[model samples]
Target: MKFAQPWGRQRLSFLLEKAASREAQTWRGYVAKKQTSQDADVSPAQRDEAVRWLTELHGRLQLYPETLVLAVSILDRFLAPIKVRPKYLRCIAVACFFLAAKTCEEDECVPSLKELAASSNCGCSPSEILRMERLILDKLDWDLHTATALDFLHIFHAMATASRSGFLDSIGLNRSQHLGLLTRRLYACLADHALMQLRGSVLALALISLELETCCPDWLALTIDLLRKAQMDSSALIRSRELVSRSLSTPRASLPPNTVYIYHPLQLAAPARRPLGTMETPRDQPALPQAAAGEESKAPPPSPKHLAHLQKVPLRCKASTKRKVEQMDVDDFYDGIKRLYNEDATSAVHEGATPGGGAYSGGSSPCPPLQPVGAS
Candidate 1:
């Protein structure tokens, strides 16, 4: 995670070299050729739509950004080898996303096939996704760890930070924040099929170079060093930088063509209209008393039936007498005992009952009243 470190330079160089080689071997220009023809199997517009779909699913599932980039790479690579119809593009896209999530995310973070299919709403069943997954794996030869543009973006960003510490301090962003901004820009560039012509290393370097020019004073020097390290041509980096700048600057359409907007008004009902030929006169209108008119506007009182429905039902206590006595507080138990003694004393004084009959006497009670025992 430490971007300003010297220990990772060798690893960064190796990653850049691997990504460049794989891109050269696998990347194709099929989108450009099919873009102009309406009957083409997969047009650039369709590919862009598919990529957008994968981006949305990535956010919806809360997967890592790397997963999204890897998914798009898998989709593009799969499309290069096989011709997919526009209708099946979404199914293919979902399959790629599923594969990427399994590869990049932890086992627990990866969604089940049913959940992914249902949540993505790509009009694909779990069976269809499973089948497409097999197809993609076969076509890709089960190699889903290919480096993408995001990988290069990370390398260049780390190298920039390592070269000049606090270069992004002026912008008030830490290394990760600035790198996240660059990652989003790189994702945006990926959505445009036009940038597909550029290799992953070049595209990522272009985005990084664009960001560096704005903040870093030695941006040109830094970019030159990255180009040398990545072994990318300066002309290609220049072209891709222009495309990335334009792509980020341009706003894309937010909604699809088939989108429908629904509106609901707050009014209860519309006022009734008079007949076209009707003429209203003062004498023809009925006169209403002030009290009646005021009453008419007020809400009516609830009926007896509604009042009955609103009444609360009392809950019944189910405790037995012994249970209730066991649960009683000490004060309440002593109070009850004192009341019984007073009642017995009062009865004996009135009726002159004998002490043997469990009555109270003046000098000494027949038997001392029992005291309440505290529970342990």
Candidate 2:
């Protein structure tokens, strides 16, 4: 009864399917035209360089599959919008990772944009990462509901369990061991370098195949093989496994988060506290209660500054009630305001200060993106 008719579950699947359909359709033609047209640009060397960098990036972070998938999904989505070359390679990859960690990780301890900027060979500063994130989000049109590794985890679990329902139910399945192995295999999914290859969809497919091969091949792949339901060829699945192995063989392939990749996951421009002599910011400036306990929710009258910001997100409010900013014809202007206001408040508190106080700098750059290949 628990999973049966689970409220909103259907919606999740539907959204993921819709997004997948769109990515498939849009990319198919785009790939063909680019491949045939000399004007399409991007040489083999460039492609290899992109793949190697992405692979290096994937290796550097110690995130679980959940976080990695989120990062990868964000990168893929952002790729569609922001154009980059080896020149700005590390900056874009790092920016995308920051966005993904914020989106997926349960307990994040990454570094601040400033700290990362200090270490980056890319010469991109904290403000630069901050600016790039906004550009990335704008490029992707603020779509967040991508199918990360966690989403796929559930699917794989159900399929595996379904195949063994009788045996598992009767023998009292050691769900923990099984799940542990599955999670380790799942982490490997993040290593596919799908972000650079323009083959992220393959990563998901490859991950599922590897999980089956390593965990419960009988349940997942064997079942699929018997049913002949999957679209992938058996030989392709074998190649996917080999690639996963080859990725692991390269030690430089993945590494834990240091100043290089993982940031503190704090706000972008939050710590810029103005001197007391400065004029009080307009009704728009966002602020947070300084709960030394790091617990602001318990505060009784959490500064109206915080409340002033909450009312900014574009919730499902009636159009008549929405702000003039929200009513703007352009959707991103509406979104930028939300991030500048709502998330800025929360991100700022963690940053231990206020955002760049009312600079009003457009900080615009080339559009970047992240497409939730699994959802709308």
> Which structure among the candidates has the greatest TM-score?
1
- Per-residue alpha-carbon lDDT of candidate 2 for residues 1-376, written as tens digits (9 for 90 to 100): 0122222434544544554564554332112113444435333345334434444544565544455556556655555443455456567767877776676555445656665566444578878888888888787778755545445344445544555545344444555555555555545444434323423444445555654554453645454642243244666555655776666556544553243655587567743443211223235645543663246222222324544554343333122534434434334543465555554444333322224433232333243222335864
Q: Number of backbone collisions per candidate, in order?
A: 0, 15
Candidates in order, TM-scores: namely 0.64, 0.44
For model 2, what is the error of residue 57's alpha carbon versus the real structure, in angstroms, after optimal superposition?
7.4
lDDT (Cα, tens digit) per residue for candidate 1, span 220-326: 99999999998878898888888888888875834543577799878778434432211222455676666975663332222244334322323222246754444
Which predicted model would earn the best lDDT? Answer: 1
